[model samples]
Target: MAGPGEFELIREYFSSRFQTGAQAGGVDSGVVLGIGDDCALLTPPRGKMLATSVDTLVADVHFPASADPYRIASRALRVNLSDLAGMNAEPLWFTLALTLPESNAAWLEPFARGLADTARLYGITLIGGDTTKGPLSITVQVTGSCDRALRRDGASAGDHIFVSNQLGAAAAALPIVLEEYEPSEVQQQQADAAFYFPEPQLELARSIGACASAGLDISDGLLADLAHICEASGLGADLKLDTFPIAELAQSMSADAALETALTGGDDYQLCFTVPAKYLDHLQGLQLPITAVGRMREARGIDCFLGGKPWQPRGTGYRHF
Candidate 1:
């Protein structure tokens, strides 16, 4: 027997289920046209610029092939949302292109449910996209609006570097996920949680946009992502290794292992940004769990120090090649 057709699949699983909180006859949602259209029509909030980003996640390349569809859907959406947060943009809507080996209701049902739930939580509407038969992959293109976007080239020498929340939790979970390490139940739970549900620092992004000179989400490990800011700003960074905010799961391992995971492991969707030193007090007032890990310097590369001496980590980060 044949499965649901493409249009039937979209109508049942996607179309109306992902509508924004906008009324059908109203202009409040900024979405003039949503799913099922040949093209989606959106009106940007007056005087605000549209910030758009696209991300693609392939099975096994970005997530475990055997990962739950719900978690996979959540991760795909959240990671794209993280990009909008890094730009200090308010998410409005997104388009999803899904390629699957076959149309299975068992998988599509949960995937759509997870996607819809996450979209609602983030206040984003599903605008439009395509579905095809192929290797499993998901591509999300998100559009947000912002008055001013925090950019990579804005960091100045003497600017202080900050990262949101603890790092390396997701990295620490990788060994357990791959079945290479056996961790305690609590440790496993903590690491797995971090890996599965990365919270995009959207509120923090809005609060810091005015004060932060440069920023990016730490999807590619803190050190590697920070290096992007340094390179773009024509500056270097000196990170206080001892000040690295290690996650609880990472702390469960040896000090060296924890530090390595923190420095080189990827999939941590936190924010790494730079703010002028003068805004230190203002930043502190925000009361978010942000950590001042280092400062931008006049030199041209990143220099990490532990115990007042230069420290080199084992790996740089995850690379696509």
Candidate 2:
């Protein structure tokens, strides 16, 4: 099949994808400002600061081509939102760079629909983006503006570490994709749903607000990603591996598989944050209960305790190398 030109491709596939209509009347939504001109226009509320982050989803790296395009769109946008959440910022606008092999309306329609739904859910707008012919990849840049922004360096020694939601859903989905094990109907649905439709915990992050000293969403496995916080905060971590929230279905897998999924696996997208022990009650009040997995110390290194024994990962999680 012949590929459509770039303009036709954008018109058919991406034009209505973000559903920024609520910001409308200017263009798609009833809002007053337009983004179609060479220079896009945006108006933000006063005293708000902008927090920006960019994420790239590469073919065979981020998601499999056979996976639902709608899911791909949702995950791509949600991941960026997750970052904003980690910083306790409110999302305002997003820009997308879509590289596609060819144009197919069937794939683009639901994809755009899913993208729009997520944007609406988070009260974010898609101001502009560029599309080009190439391999399948999506690079999303999300900007969240806030009066106060959270930073990783704010974490101090003696802070308690916490996480929202269970870990390893994305890891658990891998075997199903590889056809190694056939998941039960319910298990398949649970794993696949969480993997495909990741909830970035934007509200949870925003709610945590001042309670979170240092924060980040767990994309590249908990141990590795948290280590980034450790390094940045000038601290070390003592983690309780067993305290990790693993799903029951995921637990049914082999011990090695479960641990591997939990430790070295990536794409969980849950938030890992630190808060002063004095603020523990604050976190609990939000109902975002956290396992007292470990402590942050002035010392340097990552250590883990599994079943009351010492543990060290054989390798870092999800390295491209």
Candidate 3:
């Protein structure tokens, strides 16, 4: 194949592929101009607020450098979308900045397909971005809209704490992802899904809506992330360790090991939120996969109880520094 120039590469693999999403738009959806221009023109809904987030994933640091191109694209976009979900926002549009060592058509084809498929599934459009020659890295900036956005500082004492679903799967899957541990076929599938196709909790956040006092997606460990909520809300939390919903991927580990991972291991991407006492019943009535594992307190720090006794985790959370 001929060496693809930057403009041709963008046209073939990005702009053209992203147009499918534009055609699927509704009357109220935004996007006066998208890819092919120097900038994207957008129209936010009349009364809705825009929620935007950006994430940069470098090769080896975020995912395996030798991983599948398709899965890489999926993980990259979905993780950014998780941020919008954390803020209780609906998907709108996103920009992609891709840095590559070389423009290999074989690689770009699958990567583009993966990105387009995910954008299509999430109902988000590809706006505009830049391409550069460098070591592999993907930077995605997503913008969404919301009627009533969730905030980190909205909790108070006597509020119930909840997580959208089971935790620690992505953390537990790291070993399998790095090939440090060999797993059964089913276990391997579980690991791949956890690490590659993590679901953004958009619907659950939408369901929680006005009833949620505070919320954030669990990119960090449960305890570490819960501390964020505590810090933001200016309150503490008392958690029941026994009530944690562990993921099946981590269930095969020793009980203590599993609990430790669930508490300190990061990358789950599920939503951790608080509901005031008065809204507890309303939140529960939604019948989501949420569980109240703790309660916000008047104290200024988070405390954990296992078997009715104080418990501690091995670590706080992942530190980039």
Q: What lDDT does model 2 reach?
A: 0.74
Error of 2 at 7 (Å): 2.7
Query: Which of the two, 2 or 3, has more TM-score?
Result: 3
Q: Whose TM-score is greatest here?
A: 3
Superposition error at 46 for model 2 (Å): 1.6
Clashing pairs in 1: none
For each candidate, what TM-score against the reference? 0.93, 0.88, 0.94
Cα displacement (angstroms), candidate 3, residue 179, comes to 1.1
lDDT (tens digit, per residue) of candidate 2 on 1-321: 223565455754554554333353223332344344454566655576778999999978777877788888888998899888878888778887788887777877787888888888888788777777789999999887776566778789989888777776777776665556777898788777667777777777778877778888888888888889998989998888776777555677676556656766777788888889898886787776455678898899878888999987655323330
Q: Which of candidates 1 and 2 reaches a greater TM-score?
A: 1
Residue 22 of model 1, lDDT score: 38
**Candidate 1 to truth, TM:** 0.93
Pick the lDDT winner: 3
Counting clashing residue pairs in each candidate, in order, gives 0, 10, 0
Off by over 4 Å in 2: 1-6, 16-32, 178-180, 255-257, 315-321
Instruction: Give per-model CA RMSD.
Output: 2.8, 3.5, 2.7
Report lDDT (Cα) of residue 27, candidate 2. 38
lDDT of each: 0.83, 0.74, 0.86
TM-score (C-alpha) between model 3 and the true structure? 0.94
